[model samples]
Target: MRRVGREEPRAGRAVLPLSLTLVSGILDAVSFLGLGHVFVANMTGNVVVLGMALGGSPDFSTPGCLVALAGFVAGTVVSGRLAGAVPRPPVPALVVESVLLVAATAVAFAGLTPGRRFAAIGLLGLAMGLRTASIRLAGVSDITTTVITSTLAALGARSALAGGDGAGWGRRLGAVLLLLAGAGGGAWLILRWGPGVALVAATGIQAATGGAYAYLSRRRP
Candidate 1:
């Protein structure tokens, strides 16, 4: 299946980006499975779900989908603003992501009852969307946590008949695998540990990543 993650930054390790990818996956899984049948990261799926809901699809929650769509937009906007304002590189980007994720985690944990889908979905979507956007703005290229259409497409083409430099395949594969792991883990957590598990895990990972960045920046700065 064409090994991935070839686009490695000159920095230390790919742990941070890979963690962020998992964050995206977990958020996607929770949003789709536990909170509501919507995707916080994959806006395309969110739109499709929204359309189906509007069309009176069975068991589709219109309110939930609309809420997620709106939250994701808000998150993206917030992330963009943060990236523009914050200094480039170092821990700034991760700082913003960590803050947003922590906030979302609070929301999720506070309302993690069997029926608190609104808070769960809304909070997670807001945080995840913002984190993904932050990754984009930070120039963490080819590590989009949400969707993988272009990445997969490129991987398929480049690793195929074209026979070009496959430097980024490792990173690409890392992103995909991290996401799948997140989704699978999220689904399992939701089914076993409940909705709170997903948000807790996501937030915790982001916070750790942020801390690592901060430490690294200070050491090098």
Candidate 2:
């Protein structure tokens, strides 16, 4: 149990959210560059693009991103429904996110010719949103999974006021760094090879995370 004014146990359980954030970054980068300058993982960026599109910006498209956002909402709905039935964050999250990944894998496999940009973008966005909502409901604080601004802000505040102990600053810092790593690597993979490679990598990472959570749950019992 957490005190009203105190931070939760960041050293152990809190690490779970960061892992999902890393997954978010990778998928975001892949969707951004490969999916026609749209974002599946980071809705903030997608919303920004949406606004620009409405403002008649040449670089962004209004309809394309709206589709991604809709898919994301659908994905979130799916995740929320799963949560309602299970009522456990970690296990339910794993189940929902793994299903999203299966959807993503199916899209990737279906679009293996490397040309169905819209299909990939839509599927990727839905998968990411579903996975993100699961993490958000896990009751993590200081990390939003899909959004980095608050995470960075929290890291700064904690690192500065760390005083003597720093109160789990390492984990927060690790979250930021892991997100960067995911984005950078995802971008690199997409640019060098193709969306297929990045999708594969993202799928593998999430699958492993699900496996880890399941293993930990078993051990706890």
Candidate 3:
């Protein structure tokens, strides 16, 4: 476990990445169900939808998928440049993620109606991309927050039932459950209130995650 702020890594102290994962699930759900038939955080789904669009599926849009993929990649590029600029514990990265998520929430509500849905998708995708890239450099294990394919694989491989040591199962299980809970909550919010409320909720959680990290870093040092 890599230290985020010079403190010794403790067991069960995975609130930060779990929160980010929850945000990802929420944003992805909002984007898919509310904004458009597209995924902002889950690029794999976008790729599949893009393929469907190319195959003449009327339900998907090539332009929307392209925008999201481009935005996500661009965010990764931006974060790559900032990776060297930030100090230890990835505080700068968290700041950047928080700001991006807030901006995404604002953009989603800034008249991004059905006509301008692609713009909102791009913004949210960019934020997720930035977050994924920055966190990659953080050296955290079993908390990618963006995708769980690897996490699922790890869980299966490390499970005692699979003839291996049951290490890292807790993180993997927590991530899976958090993502599920987030997606369910986002869907409920979208059905009851609107996408705006879901985005606002995600932004609040992201802000809290960053704030908590900042406080912990300060107290540890």
Candidate 4:
């Protein structure tokens, strides 16, 4: 019974990271497809795109990628400070992220002029950075809530077929699937309605995830 009680809290904690992964996917899709062919959440992709842009690719924007990378870095710095100041780092970090997402959504609704597009990209990149840093501070294992390359690698390397114990396979698989689902849903919504609608949806999911995490933290002993 005691073990079950302990396990329940761990399970509850997993929900927040997984939900954030979905949020990252939606934001990445929206940014890459609608904004300026850059990734806000997945900085790895953003870096590669930036390199491509530097190499004279007309399909990418150098300025947009740079802004996103800078914004993400700034957000991580802010998150580190926030984590040190607050007893519960994730709560405050998530609150800030949610606020930034809301602002990004508002900007998206306003218009996607060249200037506003960069603004939205920077805002999203910053928010994702905050989320990533907070999750790191929380020490959640096997879920990154953003890039899944490492997760995929670990999944393949640790699979029973590879003569290794399938530890963390479930969470890794779920992260991949959720990220895929979020990206697909985000792209569909962008095509059907607009990027603004997609940002609105992403903002709602982010806010809900923050709220759920806060509630769960409060309930945990």
TM-score of each: 0.83, 0.83, 0.90, 0.94
1 versus 3: better lDDT goes to: 3
- Per-residue CA lDDT of candidate 3, range 33-132, in tens? 8877888888988999999999999998888889889989988887777766555435666777778767767776776675568778878878888878
- For candidate 3, which ten residues in a row score worst on lDDT? 3-12
| TM-score between candidate 3 and the true structure | 0.90
Tens digits of per-residue lDDT for model 2, 14-71: 5567777788888888777766677887888899999999998998767669878988
lDDT of model 1 at position 66: 78
Model 4's alpha-carbon lDDT is: 0.86
Clashes of 1: 15
Q: For candidate 1, write residues 96-166 as lDDT tens digits.
A: 65666666666666775634667666666676677667666665566676787777887777774678777
Model 4's number of clashes is 0
lDDT of each: 0.71, 0.70, 0.79, 0.86
> How many steric overlaps does candidate 3 have?
1
Provide C-alpha RMSD values for all models, in order: 5.1, 4.1, 2.5, 4.0
lDDT for each residue of candidate 4 in 78-127, tens digit (9 for 90 to 100): 88888677767788888999999989999998888999998998999899
**Which structure among the candidates has the greatest TM-score?**
4
State the displacement of the C-alpha of residue 177, model 2, in Å, after optimal TM-score superposition.
Answer: 0.9
- As for lDDT, the candidate ahead, 1 or 4, is 4
